[model samples]
Target: MIENDCSDLFVQNFSFWKHLTDTEKQFLCDNTAPVHYFKGTNVHNGNSDCIGVLLIKSGQLRTYMLSEDGRDITLYRLFGGDVCILSASCVLDAITFDVFIDAEEDTDVLLINSAAFRQLADQNIYVKCFGYQLTAARFSDVMWAMQQILFMGADKRLAIFLSDEISKSGSNEIKMTHEQIARYMGSAREVVSRMLKYFSEEGIVELYRGGIRIIDKKKLHSLI
Candidate 1:
């Protein structure tokens, strides 16, 4: 059981929290627990555990899958205040494939027990609808990632990824290694290194010891 008051946290993250009946709210509060994970810790692996819905309280989580060749490809990421329904996929019949969730940074999350949440979802229309809507939205993100891998060129994909990172962090310098970038894009590290070298040669970016800095944002966007 959660030790401190997390009612406010639930209400802020779960849109349906306010609509839940008193009994339903009580059930959730009873079953939910606060958990913390260090960076690089695997929260769930291969759908083996039903960890249930995660309401991120702080830090970030990376939801990824293993390719047939055993490469990790990121499907999506969740940050503070984001609700993660995918970690509870075992309770959702529609999701059949294996998924892995890991902490990208030290993180804290409120975990609602899968059976309890599933029970509520079955009884409450609002809860059910919220689950379905969030699942659909996450699936949309997965599809976009798949499309980028299948249709977009490496240059365009890399450009979009860098631009997105810059926008998300509000910083021109991206603190990631080429191997990390390759994993996110589901590409080979060598390919990403070659592309980055090309970008550096073209005066689009400057590669430093451990990160890349944007030299020309317009040039980067032109490739997208």
Candidate 2:
């Protein structure tokens, strides 16, 4: 029960909130609490007690797991409009997977209680539909990530990831360290660094202090 003033954030994503009925929106506004976390903070630890859904309002979070050998395998990066599943599953089944979430940047989240969610879904058809859609989208993304890990080569996978990030941010320049890239790529940081260096030598990209800037989009696309 962290608390913050959410008056500004409440209307920031009108479309997402507008999907719910007037009453439903009011119910959430009344019950949901706003919480803020600084960068590198843990939102929730793996296998922790189930809570309610966390609706991201701003910033980014990386959900990941640590391997036995002390490596991080990133699952996904959750941003604004994205809902964390731990809260949803806790409300529905009182159980959830062991997943760790860390704030990639300072983040704001709307903490909706399980009881409030259940009540809203029980009364609002649109809310139920929205929930279903979100679940489906999450499943699809997981499937796609799994497919890439199993079937794609490391270089191709890196290229695809970079391409997607560039498209999402609408810029060829991406702000991510080699360690971050390694987590997402499910490879060693040293390996990722070597690959990036190779790409740089090939004039495929330019490495910066805290990021990589794609210089030759056509050639990078050809790699994938």
Q: Rate the local accuracy (lDDT) of all candidates.
A: 0.90, 0.76
Backbone clashes in model 2, listed as residue pairs? 52-87
Give one digit per residue, the lDDT tens place, for model 2 in 156-209.
888888898999889989999999888887777887888899889999999989
TM-score of 1: 0.93
Per the 3 Å backbone cut-off, how many clashing residue pairs does candidate 2 have? Answer: 1
- What value of lDDT does candidate 2 attain over all alpha carbons? 0.76
lDDT of 2 at 47: 60
TM-score of each: 0.93, 0.77
| Best prediction by lDDT | 1
**Each candidate structure's count of clashing pairs:** 0, 1
Off by over 4 Å in 1: 1-4
